[model samples]
Target: MQNDLVSIITPSYNSEKFIAKTIESIINQTCENWEMIIVDDCSPDNSNEIIENYMQKEKRIKLIKLKKNSGPAIARNMAIEQAKGRFIAFLDADDIWLPEKLEKQLLFMKENDLSFTYSAYRLIDEEDNDLGVFIPPVLADYSSLLKTNFIGCLTAIYDTNKIGKMYMPNILKRQDYGLWLKILKQIKSTKGITEPLAIYRIRKNSVSSNKLKAAMYQWKIYREVEKLNIFQSMYYFMNYAYYGLKKY
Candidate 1:
């Protein structure tokens, strides 16, 4: 494995069907200075077998299996703890990266000297079929990120030099958003690559489809956790509505 590599942390659970493609995407990256760290949150399916098989052939791929079934937040934290990269990138096991995803984002980060960054992503179905692309409305600064969690986890890459660790709440959902909020607390600006560099697989029976549940978690993160006022909550609520309607 390359030292000081760009570590790609992937949190997986029951991802047997899609893990291979996700690993392949990492393998196919045009930028080769990366190591993929796959953390299995005690998947009940054949995900471990799939990952182990691939690891046998690809030395750059590393697998770590948790003893219990923690949520994505804890799983991701485990991967991040084991990461040894100058820059840390995240990729969910079901999502995929474009060929030039790392190359483009790395150059953008280096040129701008930005600590954290994300990119536009294409929405895909459970079968890995593409839906229409969903580009970010605009690049976000600290204030704008308060309104919405517009940055997809798969499209996010951060400089470890500035923000060494990404700490996530061990909640059921919205962990990614919570981590972004935590990241922004330390850094003022978060950049975005306008081009789509990844595919976000919208699972058929995913929790993200539950608007009420998602809103509840967001409210908890914003109000009880972050201590946002009612007005801020309403603003974020409306933003969620806009994104939900547009995405659906």
Candidate 2:
């Protein structure tokens, strides 16, 4: 793995409207030693075309074309497999990172010798109007995370040197949560900053916005993926439901 280099994994599907700005956000970062690997999951839109246009100028931006319309889990796993960097981060086609995000977060990790970290972020609507800011817990461990997933995938980073490489389970939903849980099992806890570092776009039709469906997916992860028993799953699910309702 390339020391001190960050590999950003992104998944795109019909993201033509937001992909350009997303790529530009990375380009405008204060930290320069990063490669963005964007996987296009058989997008039948101009997403790949826009990415290709950027690739002509920015050699750091790479694209992977999936033969089939695989889910984001498969897309991200493909990027992780090919990552040449010691540090790994995640960004989606619609999110935006602040200019100082990488510079500050990297220093925070190195100075404190942290293996996993995430930060608070702001929420934006489809048209880019600000909704509100979110501040996650300052620190969390495997037990705390089972109740709810506080790490926003876009704001998370993990060091491969410490725990080797961790991959997400092949699930259609809650894959990001699964990965965070997997990492926490090895590390003492994940740290975070209260300052907002990224922008999250909340779409009306996002699968996560479907409360009932999301609850079901969470339950599946607790039972089927984590192998939690009936009572244990119920205990965690109840806590998740309470906090889940509190999320924006």
Residue-pair clashes per candidate: 0, 0
Q: Give one digit per residue, the lDDT tens place, for model 1 in 115-220.
A: 8889999988987677888777556765666676789999988878777776777778888887788887788666787789999998877767667777788788
- What is the alpha-carbon lDDT for the whole of candidate 1? 0.85
* Candidate 2 lDDT (Cα, 0 to 1): 0.92
Model 2 segments more than 4 A misplaced: none
For candidate 2, the per-residue lDDT at 103 reads 91
Clashing pairs in model 1, backbone N/Cα/C closer than 3 A: none
TM agreement with the true structure for every prediction:
0.94, 0.98
lDDT per residue for candidate 2 within 1-248, as digits (tens), equals 25889999999999999998889999999999999999999999899999999999999999999999989999999999989888999999999999999999999999989999999999999999999998999999999999988889999999999989889899998899999998988886868998999999988888666888888899999998999999999999999988987875
TM-score of candidate 2 against the unseen true structure: 0.98
